[model samples]
Target: MKKSTLLIILLFITIYTYAQRDQTNQEPGSTAFWENLSKLCGKSFEGEMLNASEKDQFYGKKLVMHVRTCEDGKITIPFHVGDDHSRTWVLTMEEGGMIKLKHDHRHEDGSEDRITQYGGTSSNSGMSKIQFFPADQETTDLIPYAATNVWWITLDETSFTYNLRRINNDTAINVKFDLTKEVETPPTPWGWED
Candidate 1:
């Protein structure tokens, strides 16, 4: 074969190999779920507590969640409860078809809270519309009481729900948002601008 033709063939082979490697590294279902959630980027939605108790801190407050930032491998969502802008959920894509969920809590001055960056990674290749994250070691170490907390999110065409349940216990929280209606985007979450 001509030297130039040989070089061109080798280049094509290298490109094809790299493409296949990337595809095999990601879990298809997780990737689809991530992309679906990413579609809501820059939009804000209003939500309500599905199981509210009088003792619940967020029971009577106006709840909002803004899918504020979306990037190649990460998505940042700031959750607002009435006047508080202290909670942000950070979802990051990981190797081997896994996704990590971390709670980024900040103060008004954009400083990290003492209890922050606590969450877990997906244990399996969940469905395209849902994923589950069991509390990681960091969460258990930071808050021993929440060692059994399992957080899961479900996204569909019309609604999105964030849920938490402690294994072998009765503690659970569920918040459902209406995706059919877009709400005014809230201000930035604490400590994010910096």
Candidate 2:
């Protein structure tokens, strides 16, 4: 019993140490990454209500994504889940534009089933286009096919917003967001039952 316990503990330590090293060795977040994500920082923007298709989802229940940035050059996007008034968020730019957007879902025993992921890519648009790549399989599934949630974020001093939608069949059924116009919107993310 003692040997087994020691082995497990040592394994956890090794894993933790590796994760730390991996994070520290990552590149810094691109200026474009911050500039793009910062567009929605102060505004209390809301999206339109929508729904999910056969394999699609909107996560409606009144979830709110609050954008903010700390002094340490880190970005915080807090997503408020309406069902239990719980909150999770996407913390970015720590080791480059690596993002970890967590969910409020949980297993039967109260163990949160939230997902952590990485996103963002090389500054390819003269600070205009930043690729939000999926770091893993789970994150990829969340993407809406070729019409995935990958955004082509356009940023400027006047406004900051993103459009996360794609064509489903012959129609753009899951139009996730279209608020880059710098205008106030409905109380939910667009592209679902409203």
Candidate achieving the largest TM-score: 1
Clashes of each: 1, 11
lDDT of each: 0.92, 0.44
- Angstrom error of the Cα, residue 117, model 1: value is 0.6
Superposition TM-score, candidate 2 onto the true structure:
0.41
Model 1, 81-148: lDDT tens per residue? 99999999999999877889999999899899999999999998688999999999999999998899
Q: Which residue segments of model 1 deviate by more than 4 Å?
A: 1-27
lDDT of 2 at 158: 44
